[model samples]
Target: MDLSEIKGRIREKSNIVDVMAEYIRLQKVGKRYRAICPFHQDTKPSLYIDPEKEMFHCFGCGAGGDVFNFIMLIERLDFMGAMKLLAERAGITIGDIEHKKGD
Candidate 1:
């Protein structure tokens, strides 16, 4: 499959909360989940996760994005690297990708 197709499959199979819970603790708050931001030093729980939207946002550090972007930042990896890892986590096989610098 092409790269975009592979990414779409990975996203389809991934549960944002389930995937993030593997890295950090999440507390349910009404309709959303709240957690401390792992991207920066935080005094309180600033990251809010909306499972319905499949998105996360940190008020303190201004870090916000979907699941793939979260993986990119937290793992200190580029887009392709995050995609590969996410695919593996979701049990989606990805074909070989030519990863080069400044991607």
Candidate 2:
């Protein structure tokens, strides 16, 4: 499979709410959730996460994107690093497996 396909699968498998919850306290609001924006000095719950949409947006800092983008920003990691981390969390294997399996 292509790397993009794997990335898409990882994104789909990894829940945005669950990932954000691991880093910050999320309060349930209606069908969505809210939290203090980590990107800026936020006293209020500026960070809003919509689990149904699998996306997040921070009204304070204007930070918004999918789970991968969130991980990159919050974790202070590069795109590939975030991808690797999320891939492991989602139980998605990376690199060659068929060759290694035979060995």
Candidate 3:
């Protein structure tokens, strides 16, 4: 397993709504979920989640991305750190991936 493989597993195993629910309260709206944007001071539900696309977008503050990006921003972690965190959440081991020459 490499970075791409890890990402794929994370996407496959993690649901956007489920992950977002851990950070904020979500209300189902039509086919998506709505929540107050975590990136800014939001009074109304401005963050929308599209589970089919596995993506989220904030209309009020313009914060948006996939689950990994959300985790990175919300957790204040870099790419690899977010990957490791999400891997653990998805029950995938980072040790399964072969380390690069210098890493």
Candidate 4:
């Protein structure tokens, strides 16, 4: 699959609330969940998780995205690397883990 296809798959499989909760101290806030941003030093809980959209946004530092984007940003990885990372987390295999996308 291509990068876009991989991103789509990751988005479909990712749960925004769950991924955010893993890295942040999250709390239920009205219809969404809030947490301090992990990408940068944050206070006042500027990170928000919208489970309905399967995405997160950080008002403090502008960090935002579906889980793939989150992983990419957090891990300093490219799109394929992020997909492979999440695929491992989800126990979805795509051939050799060390293989590049088109290799």
Q: What are the candidates' C-alpha RMSDs?
A: 3.3, 5.8, 2.7, 3.8
Candidate 3: lDDT of 71?
A: 94
Q: What is the TM-score of each candidate against the true structure?
A: 0.89, 0.89, 0.90, 0.79
Model 1 earns a TM-score of 0.89
Give each model's clash number.
0, 0, 0, 0
Model 4 lDDT per residue over 4-66, tens place: 555566667767677666766889988898887888888688988888888889999999988
lDDT of candidate 2 over 50-97, digit per residue (tens): 999999999988999999999999999998899889999989887742
CA displacement after TM-score superposition, residue 3 of candidate 4 (Å): 4.7
Candidate 4 segments exceeding 4 Å error: 1-6, 96-103
Lowest lDDT 10-mer window, candidate 2? Answer: 94-103
Model 3 residue 96 lDDT? 65
Task: State the displacement of the C-alpha of residue 83, model 3, in Å, after optimal TM-score superposition.
Answer: 0.8
The segments of candidate 3 whose C-alpha lies over 4 angstroms from its true place after superposition are 96-103
Candidate 3 lDDT over residue span 66-88, tens digit each: 99899999999997888888889
Task: Mark the 10 consecutive residues where model 1 has the least summed lDDT.
Answer: 94-103
TM-score of 4: 0.79
Better of 1 and 4 by lDDT: 1
Query: Higher-lDDT candidate among 1 and 3?
Result: 1
